[model samples]
Target chain A: MGDNMSELLNVKNLKTYFFTKYGTVKAVDGVSFKVDKGETFGIVGESGCGKSITALSIMRLVPDPPGRIVGGEIVLEGEDILKISDNEMRKVRGKKISMILQDPMTSLNPVFTIGIQLEEAIKIHQGLKGRSLRERAIELLEMVQISSAAVRYKNWPHQLSGGMRQRVIGAISVSSEPRLLIADEPTTALDATIQVQFLRLLRELQEKTGVGLVFITHDFGIIARMCQRAAVMYAGRIVETGSVRDLFDNPSHPYTAALMRSLPKLEEKVERLASIEGQPPPLNDDIQGCRFAERCTVAEHQCRLSYPDETEISDGHFVSCWKF
Target chain B: MQRYIVIRFIQTVITLLILSIVIFTLVRMSGDPVLLMLPETATEEDYELMKSQLGLNKPVYQQYLIFLFDAVKGDFGKSIRTRKPVILSIKETLPNSIKLVTVAFVIGFALSIPLGIVAAVKKGTVWDNMARVVTGLGQSIPTFWVGLMLLQIFVVWLRILPASGMDTWQHYVMPATCLGIFLMSGVARLLRSSMLDVLDSEFVKMARIKGVRESVVIWKHALRNSLLSVVSFGGMYIAIMVTGAILVETVFAWPGFGRLAYAAIVNQDFPLIQGVVLTAGAVVMSANFFTDILYAYLDPRIRVQV
Candidate 1:
């Protein structure tokens, strides 16, 4: 975690399946990515596009019975996490890489105070005790710019405003100062003003603590604001990856192109925002060709028959469509 | 939280009033305790005199009002069957009933939390499936039948325990097993669903991704959240055991109020029946009232959602 050349977090060929009554739903299939030190990496896609599922797989937070991580490798700092025991995995969870969930509303325990929950995470990770723990929790609260940290720190989750709760969640995540922070749709539930404040605060924190961040979201505006690099997912695969600027300015994949166009631009007054037609493919579909082929603007005969492999278009830019 | 408490208290009071009216009316309607108390030589005049003295000759509403009044003053009428103070009768035997119910509650809570957790955590695994089957059986079978079967096995055949009475810890095994079986299964099934739901919550997943200890995740985040449902069932079960204890108390002939009240009811003993029924109403009401306060205490959302 302290060293530079060493990868902070590396995931390879991750596959998570849900064995339901109907069939095995491949929620996350053959996904791979890496988060470097102190940089914000974002995964952007439409709903049910496996963006969130990829994050869940990385955390191994999949529910058992129906949900299982069938195959994959989760390499965290030279160690294969998937090979580790559940007991050991739990020990590594809070101390190494902490996660902030999608909805701050349901993420905190209803019974506990924000301070108590934050302290619980701190106590377990830092082994802080008694008065020291309280002080540490207050310090963490203040770090997130929560006003009256001393007073509001003692209040329960419901007592605090929604933005304040998200801030408390941020405080808890950074409490241990882990090298990696997995923020799954961290600002989705917040208003635009709060969302901007939160994202800016997160970027500041990442820089200050030098913690790598994995931001998962369906909102491209969020990716544009927060991420240095972005990966575009469609159906259950990473279809494109590059700098956020590159992806936004020149989206190679047709789906990515459609997504960029669909988002309303603040600079221009257009007749209408371009929209991608048709719903997401069914969970059970084999997806022999490109998943976006049905909605792709330039769908060739080959695009409907076989899935085009990822072709590197630039130094780091990668796109999956078989186009120039 | 304050609003929730006020509403819950009002609801509990209304429930108790309705329960009081129904029990008071029915106990008197069963007829004269003296008819079953006296011999065939005792004429209709004898019954009339006894009914008049006991206030049974008055309207049912009047009897209920007097009973509710005396109940607040700690003046439960004398037991017609035993010819002793009703309060003394309850005082002498209520400890036995409390001890039994307490022991049974501890056992049921202990067994059910783990059973429910295992069922939820494992889902379709053998242990989970086995728990589901066991709970289903528990819900379908009567507590008395379960008690009888346990008695036959543990006391009747093996002689490992005494089958009846509140005399020794050994004597309690059959009765506690009987009382605990139904609740344990019902609570376990409830906890299973609740645990699964809690396990899926963002907090639980957040705990997992933190690399927090499994025990910590459960006890702090997942288990506490899961216990909210258990709190609800806890309130309901207290009321159930209050009523169920009467039957169990009489079955074992533990000399508790249950047997005395049952006998009085059979004989139509107005004083004793009124006392026991009213006391039972208070216990159930207070239990429900306390549980509502606890619900508000445990979850602030209960207040917010209201």
Candidate 2:
């Protein structure tokens, strides 16, 4: 949907599968999305919904042997990263694109100091050393609003609180000044107030650097607050992709509609919240029909027999459902 | 850190004191060493004289108190067999055991860590499976048998290394290898699992996603974190090797504290046994102390204050 100049990342038909003992798990099955410069693209889904896997696939950091990108085009700045050698992909990873994971407590190496972890990305990408390196590290820390950054540089991950450690991680991810930053539920581990502060800080950083952001989370409130565009993933596929307002106000796909219904709304005196019935189908090699058919309230005979192709409903808004 | 160390040191002292009392009483209860020392034709009067001479006539608690006081000053009395100060012999032989254990430990660590890293990186592949098989054999096989087998293959068959006697470095090959194989298996397994655990952590994945080289990700990030458990295990391993190398030593006829301790045990050399036990206890305690310090160094969270 995006033109060449504005698009920072374009992931097309990305298929990352896990070859397990039981069967092939299509973790990210033909997921397509794009993020433009200075935009926040949110990917929302329940647990095991392949949103995080899609983000990981873009970085080419998927665990091999078990998990692999069977077919895909992750075009970061007009280069197809999947076709390039691992060595080439590495150069693109932190320097061109970086990620902040979910758990800050376990995301930073416990043994190394904050400065060392930050310098890991900076020195590799920027080649700064000595006082310049130290200053750059301090600068990055300060960028993330960590006061007394110089003193905190020597501290280990365990010494810091959850929110502070995450800030340090945020500092590390931005050290290379990448084109795009993927934050996979970065604020999920933090408390409510901290989450707001973190989101605000991220928005501030994004505005300062103009880096494209891919925010993956199940939280609807985050999508409403942060994302410009959003993709709703189900059974390893994007069921709906549109502007956040469009997806919230007018969900076309049955699965997206069900999800919207489940959200707890204030000022509504409902006795109980609506929830989608049944579980998402087990992704298997021989998945014959529409994965969501069994759970879909309006599923017909045809809907149970074949998968629904994506149909564009409005300007740049697409949904995959028989009803659509 | 200082307070923690002081508290740890006190605990070690108390532990050793309890161990000393246990060793003294257990060895005494095993039967009179004087009876074993005296000749078969010796009369009752001669037995009495030998008993008094060796201080076996004293009550058990009194004897332990005297031994404990003397042991604190590095005196473990005279060996019933050699009639030499038991401490002197243990001191003379301890360096040999230390040297052997050091060599073995170096060999074990050098080989096991690499093997472990490879196994973890190439996990579930043929290389990993091969490592598992080799380490499995190392874990299951007895040290004495391993020593004999090494002697048989390297000495008798290949004729590349010496059979026994600690005259040359060549003599250490068999026993060191025997000891090392067992330690290597443990180190390799411990390191492999540790590496796997660390490698699977979100931090390692984060490191990889940060464009750090795979080598750096594995060695710098993963291996260092994995080494925490490996180092702790190493402390206990060194203590085991110091005391348990008796089997390896006997098989290879290597002159070390283990062999001396073995001989002392068999000969019922009261003073020599006590000396060897004390030395072993001290060695273990020292290893644990260093391990604690290492723990603090490796993990900043464990660094105690005041």
lDDT of 1 by residue, B1-306 (tens): 777778888888788778777876776577656676678898889888887887878887787798777876878777666778888877777677778888889888898988998898888789999999999998889776776677778878988987667777888877777778778998999999999899888877766766677777776687778888888767689878876676776666656656666776787667777777777777768887887677777877776766
Distance from true position, residue A90, model 2, in Å? 0.4
Q: What is the lDDT, from 0 to 100, of the residue B213 in candidate 1?
A: 74
Q: In candidate 1, which residue ranges exceed 4 Å CA deviation?
A: A1-7, A267-271, B1-65, B79-82, B300-306
lDDT of 2 by residue, A1-324 (tens): 348889888999999999999989998888999899989999999999999889989888888879999997989888888999999889998988999999999999988998899998999998999999999999999999998999999988888999999999999888888899999999999999999999999999999999999999999999999999999999899999999999999998888899998998886879889998899888765566677888988988988787788899999899988887
Tens-digit lDDT string for candidate 2 (B69-110): 999999988888889998889888889988988889989989
Considering just chain B, what TM-score does every model have? 0.84, 0.92
Pick the TM-score winner.
2
Error of 1 at B148 (Å): 2.5
Most accurate candidate by DockQ: 2
Error of 2 at B113 (Å): 1.1
lDDT of 2 at A245: 90
A94 Cα displacement, candidate 1 (Å) = 2.6
- Return the clash pairs for model 1, or none: A93-B210, A93-B211, A94-B210, A94-B211, B33-B268
